[model samples]
Target: MKAWRLGWARGVVELRQSFSNGGDLVSHFLWPVLMLVALFFLRDREFAGTGILLGTLALPSILGMNAAMGMVSMSQQLTADREDGTLLRAKATPYGVQAYLVGKVVSVAGGLIADLVILFVPAMFLVDGLVFTPLSLLSLLGVLLLGLVATLPIGAILGSAFPSARAQGLVQLPVLAMIAISGIFYPLTALPGWVQVVAQFSPIYWLGLGTRSALLPDATVVVEAGESWRSVETVLVLGAWAVVGLLIAPVLLRRMARRESGSSVAVRREKALQRVG
Candidate 1:
């Protein structure tokens, strides 16, 4: 109970810091603004036979992609904390690692929600054919929550496994590729069968699909697999990943935290300085 309170407080402090920091504020707005601009241009363009504007389709897909990017941010933040001795400080305190992990999850998830609002509010005015019934809102919230649960733990594990920020940057390349293949900007049905098969296995694709299901009209599902939203499949696949990630993340995080010490941090700093020089 005490740890939970401390973690929640820590998360609130970090979230406030993100708002107050100029660089962080810009980052929070930049992607949403750029995406809105893209929607502006594509608002009138048709999406093949789906009879929906490209902007309408792209809007929800972009939301899903943004949700998935939370994983990358989590990984990067963890790496940064390690380099700066934040993780070491956590290790020194009682129940600190647990509190730190909880704090990170809360802050990152909260920040993501803020970003979504920044994008979604303006987007509702910009796009056409968007359905916002009570059911749709419920579905959107469900997918967002499930997507976060599925991805963030794996992200923590990845962060724990990687030794440095540079290595973490490398992780982004594959993620970018996954986004491209996942059909965030277009219909997955239009992609080659092999690409489609590979995409089906990716959380990004399911996230996008789930978002599309929530926002797009039932007819729009014509462009999707089986000409349906596959809500059961979305829940199953994301739920499976969530279960696996939850199982593995603690083991990996504990292992990583156990390895942290002042000497290791100093050694990393020395190496980083050498690289900069």
Candidate 2:
């Protein structure tokens, strides 16, 4: 209980810093702005005679993509903290590992939600034909929450697996490829059947599908695979990932944290300085 309280406070402090820190603040806005720009170009274009504007299709899909991208943020933050010895410092404190983990989840989830609102509020003005019913709002909330549960633990595992920022950079390519195949900015129906089958396994794809189901009208289902939302499958796939990731992430994180030492941190710091030089 005390750990949760302290962790929540720490998370709130870090979340506030992210908004106030110049570089972090800029990053918080930049991606959403870029996404909005993309929506601007797509707002008027129609998707394959579905009569729904492409931007209408993309806005919610992009929201899902952003939600799933929390995984990347979690991974990157973990890598950065580990490199700088934050994990070691936390390990020395009482109940700190649990606290640190909680804080990361809170901060990352809060930041991701804020970013979504930033894009979504402005996007509502730019895009048309979106459904804004109470049920859809509930559905959106549920999907986003489930999507985070499904992805963030895997991200922690990735961060633990990669000891350095440079190694973490390699992770982005595969994630980007997943996003591409998951149909974030386009319809999944347009992709090859094999690709669609592959995408079905990705949490990102389920997130996208879930959001599109929530925000789009029933008629707009024409663009989905099999012209259906597959809500049950979305829930199942995301739930399964959430379960497996939760089970594995804690063990991996603890192992990684155990490997941290003062000497190791100093070596990494030296290497980082050398690289900078």
Q: Candidate 1, which ten residues in sequence have the lowest lDDT sum? A: 47-56
**Which pairs, if any, clash in model 1?**
none
| Model 2: per-residue Cα lDDT over 1-277, one tens digit each | 9889889999999999999989999999999999999999999999887688889989989999999998899999999999999999999999898899999999999999999999999999999999999999999999999999999998999989888887887889889999999988999889999999998888999899999999999998889998889999999999999999999999999899899999999999999999999
Candidate 2: where is the Cα deviation over 4 Å?
Answer: none
The weakest ten consecutive residues by lDDT in model 2 span: 47-56
RMSD of 1: 0.9
User: Candidate 1: lDDT over CA atoms?
Assistant: 0.92
Model 2, CA-based lDDT: 0.93
Instruction: State the displacement of the C-alpha of residue 267, model 2, in Å, after optimal TM-score superposition.
Output: 1.3
Task: Tell how far residue 163 is off in model 1, in angstroms.
Answer: 1.0
